[model samples]
Target: MVRTRLINHPLVVGLLEIAAGEIGYEHRGMIRVLCDVEQFRQTIDLVVEGD
Candidate 1:
């Protein structure tokens, strides 16, 4: 959600938690996506549901 530099890269899929909902995966080779941290934080409460 946020434009963050991943502090950790070796995160396993199981270990890395993702919010429940649909994501627009525009590219397959896109390893990461960037968004405003503030915007993400604001919408997080409404977006984040169960894992």
Candidate 2:
């Protein structure tokens, strides 16, 4: 904590911020990025299974 505070450089800060946000999502108060990896789906089968 003390070491990082001493190095108040923009580049370092930006990287550190990203790393922190990635791990500390709930506490940091930031928007989340949700993504869909696989587009293909068995829609009929999924619906039947759910029912």
Candidate 3:
């Protein structure tokens, strides 16, 4: 069975904060990004690559 994981790594959290800031919102302290394992891995790769 596929399971979901919560990603709270500092890099990922910082990225999310930056994104929320760029869009101009209070960031209310709640965020949800859903993706399968492969997509999640790809996202992390992109972030690591700074792309």
Worst 10 residues of 3 by lDDT: 1-10
Who wins the TM-score comparison? 3
Error of 2 at 25 (Å): 8.5
Candidate RMSDs in order: 9.4, 17.5, 7.5
Candidate 2's clash total is 0
* Per-residue alpha-carbon lDDT of candidate 1 for residues 1-51, written as tens digits (9 for 90 to 100): 322333243232212333211243443554432445564454443334311
The per-candidate count of clashes, in order, stands at 0, 0, 0
Candidates 1 and 3 compared by lDDT, better number: 3
Q: What are the per-residue Cα lDDT tens digits for candidate 2 across 1-51?
A: 113333354534454476566666455564322223231123223433454
lDDT (C-alpha) at residue 46 in model 2: 41
Position 2, candidate 2: lDDT: 19
Tell me the TM-score of model 1: 0.27
User: How accurate locally is residue 26 in candidate 3, as Cα lDDT from 0 to 100?
Assistant: 57
Better of 2 and 3 by TM-score: 3
Clashing pairs in 1: none
Clashes of 3: 0
**In model 1, which runs have C-alpha deviations exceeding 4 angstroms?**
1-26, 29-34, 48-51
Candidate 3 on 22-48: residue-level lDDT in tens? Answer: 654654655544445676576677555
How well does model 3 score by local distance difference test?
0.54
**Cα misplacement distance, residue 50 of candidate 1 (Å):** 12
